[model samples]
Target chain A: MKPFDRLTTSACALPLASIDTDQLIPARFMKRSRADGYGQFLLHDMRFDETGAPRPDFPLNADAAKRAEVLVTRRNFGAGSSREAAVYALVDFGFRCVIAPSFGDIFASNAVNNGLLPAKVSEADAEEILGLIETTGAAVTVDLHDCLIRFGNRNYSFTIDPIWQTKLLNGWDDLDLTLSLSGDIGRFEQRDQAERPWARLPDRPD
Target chain B: MTATRQPQTLFDKVWDAHVVTRREDGAELLFIDRHLVHEGSFHAFNKLKEKRAKVRRPDLTIGVADHYVPTRTRALSEVAPDIAGMIRQLDDNCRANAIRMFGFDDPRQGIVHVIGPEQGLTLPGLTMVCGDSHTSTHGAFGALAFGIGASEVAHVLLTQTLWQKRPKRMRITVDGATAPGITAKDIALSIIARIGADGAQGHAIEYAGSAIRALTMEGRLTLCNLSIESGARCGMIAPDETTFAYVRGRPLAPAGDVLDGAIAAWRELTSDADAAFDRAVLLDGKDIAPTVTWGISPEDALPIGASVPDPAAMDDASRASHVREALDYMGLAPGQALDTIRIDRVFIGSCTNSRIEDLRAAASVLAGRTARVPGLVSPGSHLVKQQAEQEGLDRIFIAAGLDWVGPGCSMCVGMNGDLVPSGERCASTTNRNFKGRQGPGARTHLMSPAMVAAAAIAGHLTDVRPLLRSAS
Candidate 1:
């Protein structure tokens, strides 16, 4: 996973709310190997019509938005499904950060693990940022260290779990971070085994 | 001097018991009691291989091949090679890791969430994790269960633990009695409709109230399964006699004195009298009606008596536009009566509503009635299929003209061969009605199993109550 601290790049606005993971990368596209990039499949249905023609009206189809690394959208972005491929699609599509009023709990967790920042701002601030991006096709800056998002002259603070913030700032995968406390985990397991024997499973015969 | 303990919610009790360690940043290291994996875990297995990490506790980790397994037949040879590969990958990965897999050939094989509780892997006061979002279905057993991403799946496979910050607790209490024919699915859809999909965001919801207590274990599972749709981290119902009875004789559950002791402990898994919650919501069960989703999102639901909502009537511009977009994709016109809308086909199977009770409900509705449109009724698990067959439910479905196929997550997700065709609308007993969820360009109307059966008979979205009344 790439360590992400700050990124200043072109941003696109998808003003829609409840943009679910299915829309991010549909279930059918998930069957492919992750080694094959998912960038082309990101919002595939929304970006194209039934006959496979690109929808020119979609903001991401614009030449400037095509190169965008930041996405500004409404509340409840990445709302459905626990598919991590959604985050992979965003990262593979060159999005380094997603700014929204709120995100699905699993999606936000998946985002940070893949070095993609899920920045949460106030609903009004999200709307403002999305509008600015739509009107100006602006380049926005996301500073993880300070937890701030800068669009043009206006600056808005964003919220992320401090632990996630630490992970992204260091680009540490969860396993590495978790494995650091192996000793404590072992001790806890022993104590738990004694206290709650019912929770522990007996070994099955090989 | 010792201070008196503050009253705790059911979520706190379960979560606190599983906490192995706490970081200064407020994230707790949770010890997962059960780790359920499906075919989707292949990515995590690949990551594990890259890191040269073996599964920490293979005994606690269970695998089921469902997502990509064909429901038409048990033969993998008949399936599309790419789809068949997914099941084989899970089989090989589980074999390599020494994990117990209920593979496609296993009679117990089914949707992960459905089989977890059926096999007694899901228990009260335990912490369970899975790659699928509907893992919350196990919370009906009073467990702290939630879905994780593939990266988190790898982390759990490596360490048998997960890092997490505690989510706030919300209590949704439903009192009063639901009228006959109003099912748990109706209650769940009503809750999501009132809460607006993201209403329970950032919180773990504990469902309480007389109505909740009255629901059977299957009903509770169906209710909790849809919690993720409300943006909740997880949803749980305090374990009671219903939960204990359901878990009592299951194959994987504790037996004899151990079972007795386990039930005694589970009895204590409820919220205390004065427990405080971060948020509280109250809904009258009597107000709930047979509900269905007319638009893409689950929250775009209304009672059978209502009409499709007009986007122009919505006060919020963003919400209005979303409604407009959903209407366009669904091929629905605003102000159109929901029950009058016609459907091309029907599906009655998914992790959300394919248990035996759900099957029985659909069968009761379809008995002695021929379906006007074609449909399919796949049970939640192979065991459920066998049980339904024993009870003659399969015969009823077959007689009604709906295909009685093998068990898997069929039609609910089109990952397998079963798919609703493009431009054709389907009344389905699945969780999400998202665009292309069932298949590309397939319009799905989400409802209860019995409701789906009713629609299958009527060839349109109609109230199931009248048909259910006639059945009785």
Candidate 2:
């Protein structure tokens, strides 16, 4: 993994709570591979009109938010479903960081595993960033190492669970992490075979 | 980082305490206690057989089938042949391994998470493992539980010990009484909306507050089941009298004196009075309304009265892209009121909502009101089905012309034959209204069982509050 090449940033800030995975990639997009560029399909239904014309009342239609990498939302983001496509689509859409008051349990893991940072800041601080963007269209800066999200002279220290923090910082997936402990696992298996061969072995001849 | 008072978060305590060892760029092998198993893991059992391994504590393991079963048509035999095969495999595996099997035919048969608590198998101060992600549902009883992948399932099966990288703790407190007719499902959606979909990522959440504490055991489970959906590894509520009382007399709970000793210890599972959380959020339960997903995602929902969002309101291309796709797949016209949308079918079952109480709630609504649209009300388990029948709740569903069917996970994921045809919208009682969750191209709108019943009768999405009042 590139140590510092990939930095997590957010995408469109909906300023709402309980965004579920179904909204991210929709089960329809799950039909495709991760390489199929789900980014274009991200938030499709929310962005268009019935005839498929883009709706103008939505925030994503604004020029400033179009290319913004860091999405600062209100609170409790990604609150439904265990869909990985939501995270995949977010990452594919060029968002490396998601700043919110909260996140969904499974969606957070999916985001971290996929190299998308689901950053949580206090609601006040999040609103501050949103206010800045709203008033001046200024982007907030999130420093991963400092663990701080900075906006006009204000810095909100976002708390990250140490376990998840470790995962995001190291870019280790479950498979990678499990395989990293091969030595200890091998030792335990060896001892187990010696102590309880029957439990570790097939009853029938192999 | 700016210095601030460190809140003793649930995520911090659980994560820090559980960390056995940590290394840079590696997953930690945190110790697991009281590993739980269910029948969707027949694949894991087969893999264990391939390796000639057996479970460390066959007694510590509990298995049931939830995912592959049909819920709407108790025709466990024919609703879907694939489900039958899975059920057969689960039965065979449990018998061969000597692990306790909560088969569909068993009195204990139910959704794995529901059965775990109702059966007294979920005890506080214990770590539970299940192949189901919503296994976090055990967290409601104050147990540390989360879903594991197929490989981890095999590991837990063989060693009873499963590795975990601890998550930070988050304590989400919803204070005040929930408004009348607002179910825990509404509270959960409101929290997600407030926190954003990925707010609690990398944290184990402890739901604490008068509102949460006031919830029924089943309601707590409903909240916990969606913990992962909110980007948390697991979510839990501290066990209390409600927890103990709910667990008592179950086939799995300790009998009499044994139970007393356990209850004495269970009381200690509550979060310390002064205990702080690394993250905390206080919500007013009153502001929460009946939330419904408008687009493809759960987070894309509005408070039933809201409109199909117009992405042009967004300032960015990326955001616009997501909004557009969600509307496209959902078959919604931007600016249309969500409540006005019509529904074709109603499904009332899943690990999230298919419980005895959920059935009763839906049955109460269906009692004299016939469904305007086709609907299916599936109880979470066979026992629940029987109990509903015994109470004549089944008759209410039948009288309303709803298919009160079998004991399987029917339309929740449409793994079985119970599915909505493409482009058709359904009011589902299960979690996940993602496009195609009910079937390929089928639209699923999630709600409480009662709400699903109301929608079935109205033939559209309608607030269940009025229905609950009218039913009474």
The prediction achieving the highest lDDT against the true structure is: 1
- Give the distance in Å from residue B54's predicted Cα in candidate 1 to where it truly belongs: 0.9
Candidate 1: residue A31 Cα off by (Å): 2.4
lDDT tens string, model 1, A1-206? 67898899999888888899999998888877789889999999999998989899998888988788999898889998999999999999889999998899999999988999999999899888877876887778899999998888989999998899998899887677688888888898899877766776656655
Worst 10 residues of 2 chain B by lDDT: B9-18
Task: Provide the lDDT at B77 for model 2.
Answer: 65
lDDT of 2 by residue, A168-204 (tens): 6776545444545656655655564453221221121
Per-residue lDDT tens digits for candidate 1, residues B1-472, read: 2458888899999999988888887889999999999999988999999888889889899999989889888788988899999999999999999998899998889889899989888899999999989999999999999999999999999999999999989999999999999899999999999998898889999999999999999999999999999999799999998998898888888888888888888999999999999999999999999999999899999999999999989898888898999999999999999989999999999999999999989999999999999988888999999999999999999999989998888898888979999999999999999989998999999999989999999999999888877888
lDDT of each: 0.91, 0.70
Best by DockQ: 1
For model 2, what is the C-alpha lDDT against the true structure? 0.70
TM-score versus the correct structure, for each prediction: 0.98, 0.72
What is the per-residue lDDT of model 2 for residues B178-232, given as tens digits with 9 covering 90 to 100?
8887787888877766775566766788998889989999899899987765666
Each candidate: fraction of true contacts kept?
0.69, 0.22
